[model samples]
Target: MLHLRAICPAERTDAVLAALKAEPGVTHVVLLRGAAVDPVGDVVEADVAREATDQVVASLCDLGVDRDGGVTLEQIDTALSDAADRAEEAAPGDGADAVVWEELLARTGEESRLNATFLSFLTIACLLTAVAVVTDSPVTLVGAMVVGPEFGPLAAISVGLVLRRWDLVRRAALALAAGFPVAMLITAVGTWLGSRTGLFDPDLALAGHELDFVFEVGPFSLIVALLAGAAGMLSMTSAKSAALVGVFISVTTVPAAGYAAVAAVLGQWDICLQSIAQLAVNLVGVVVAAALVLALRNRRGQVRDLGRPLGNG
Candidate 1:
């Protein structure tokens, strides 16, 4: 279930109430007339079935509630009312299977932003991967992959492609294009610093590291990339946080970047080129696969919506 809070203009309060009453999946409607001081409107609140979120939200938007007022939805983790159960039963489809597109758009938009935290995660992940390569440990490599925030922009890019939101695509592309280079630069500097200590020897590490096989760009790597991308997209659409961690390990995104950084620092141009190629392949694989998955999901949603009566789903 979800809790919806809306600020509706005084004149539109009746329309808002009518819309809520019309939705079979909506219940426990609470209205406070002229109670929104900042917006100078009526405060309307309701509990809605999760499956009906998209439609309910769309209806509110159509009423222009978002233009002059505000509409916000928050998940109701625990709805103790028997009315909530009745509302859930009235809604079509399972709640978990529903996709709230506006919510996704808002979330991906935030995730795609290249902020300080994003940069820090990417840089730290790359540094960890570099350490994994030097230490020849697969565990550390997986750690690095899990810590990487590159998936945010990748998911954003996929969403943009599916929705044909070129602005979103451009923003995500810019984030990825800028973020990787910065992370690689950090990785390189970190490697150089580590080399200053007797504990690090790039040449020796390169000769026997397990990651050499990981960096090898080949058909198998592409296969893994495709699978990882598909899984990652599914995880995002389903809101499966645990599944995302597996995706982190499945794709070679951060590991490839880390390997390239270490190779560059060690002046192994050939290895660096291979790792770069590996990175490119993985990125393309994940992005393209995710886009396809989202496109298919969108089509299915459209078909289902078409099958339903107007204003009912």
Candidate 2:
């Protein structure tokens, strides 16, 4: 279940209440008049089912209260009243059980873009990954994966496709297409400097090292990417953000890019190409899997919305 908060003038309270009461899954409504001090007005709270949240929000939006007033929805963990219990019962089971494409898209729409702080982290992570690849340190590679911010754009792309939001798709693609090339160029310069300073030796490569797992692309990599993509989407839609960290570690985009940078420094075109190929394979697998999942989820939602009487019409 979800709790919706709305603030509007006391005069407008009746209209807003009527609209909220008419919503499909709204189980409880509370009105507190002229309660706030700063920009004081009335507060209307509604308890609604999770599956019906999107429609309820849409209805409120159509009423123009979202602009004239403020509206917010938060997931409710426990219910203290009968209305709340009904709302809970109306909720879809275990938000993680299946993807809800429209809900996912709506949730993603709320995500903020990569700001300066995030970009700075990405820079530091890329540099560390580059250094790790040159030194062949598995520990540093993992650290880089933990620090990288590339997953946001990738997730945005998947959500964009599901929502059919071309602007989002273009923005995400631009971020990914531009981000890696810039990171690679910067890493290449760093590697060249390190080679001259004896901190890195181009003659020494980790191709024979047991930890050299960057270039071996196979079915396992595809499976990992697919699973990671699904998990990532689930994390985005649900409240389980901690799981996204694990998803990041499972994917190989950052490590592969780091490997490619090191291969470029060593002047090993073959290894560089191989690393690039591995990254490509993982990326393609994740995007394709995410798109398919979204498509299936959207189809199911449409059927459910139509209320087709559960059997042959």
Candidate 3:
């Protein structure tokens, strides 16, 4: 179930209440007249079935409650009322199977921003991967994968593509285009500096390392990338946080960037190229597969791009 709160302008309150009452997925409706101070409106609240969030939200937006007023949706952990149960039953689909698009849009938008935290996390993941390569630490390599923030932007790009929001696609693309290079460049510099300081041995790149798999680009790598992308997107749409971590651990995107940076620092041009290829393959594979998943998920109105586009065209 979901808790919905809409602060409606005095004139829109009746229309908002009518819409809420008309939704079979909605229950526990309450109206607090002139309750809003900042927005200066009446507060209308309701409990809605999770699976019907999109429908209920759309109804409110159509009544202009979202613009002239404010609408907020929140997850409901425990709705013990009988009406809540009826609302859930009245909903057309399972909650877990539903895609709350507004939540996803907001999430991906924030994630796609090329901000300090995103840069720091990516750089740190790469540095971790570099260390894992030098030391052949499987644990560190896995840790690097988990720490990577790249998936967020990648998911953003996929979502944007599916919705045909070119501005979203461009913003997300900016993050990827800028973030990876910045991370790789910093990791390369750090590796070189560490070598000079005796923190790492430059010759380690030439040595046989089990972590070399991080740099190997093969057909299997693409297959794994595709599978990871699908699983990642499914998890995101389903709002399963735990499943997302598994996706992170399954991909080598972060480790590949780290391997490339370390190889470049060691002047192992061939290995650097190989790692770069691996990185590219993984990224392309994930995005392509994720976009496909989103396109298919949009079938039967499971997901809809209803809001105004950020793009001009």
Best model number under TM-score? 3
Where is the poorest 10-residue window by lDDT in model 2? 304-313
Local lDDT at 305 for model 1 = 22
Candidate 3 clashing pairs, residues 3+ apart or interchain: none
Model number with the top lDDT: 3
| lDDT for model 3 | 0.87
Report the alpha-carbon TM-score of model 2 versus the true structure. 0.82
Stretches off by above 4 angstroms in model 2 are 8-12, 22-28, 34-41, 75-83, 92-114, 300-313
Tell me the lDDT of model 3 at 90. Answer: 92
lDDT, residue 216, model 3: 80
lDDT of each: 0.84, 0.71, 0.87
Error of 2 at 292 (Å): 1.8
In order of lDDT, best first, we have: 3, 1, 2
lDDT of 3 by residue, 1-313 (tens): 8899999899989888889888898999999999999889999999988788888898888888877888888888877899899988998889888888887777788888888999999999999988888787899999999999999999999998988777788888998899989999999998888889998676764488678787788999999999999999988888576798999998899888888888888989898999989999999999999989888878776555455654221
lDDT of 2 by residue, 87-130 (tens): 55666554444343344554553332544655566666778877
- At residue 89, give the lDDT of candidate 2: 62
How large is the C-alpha RMSD of every model relative to the true structure? 4.8, 6.6, 2.3
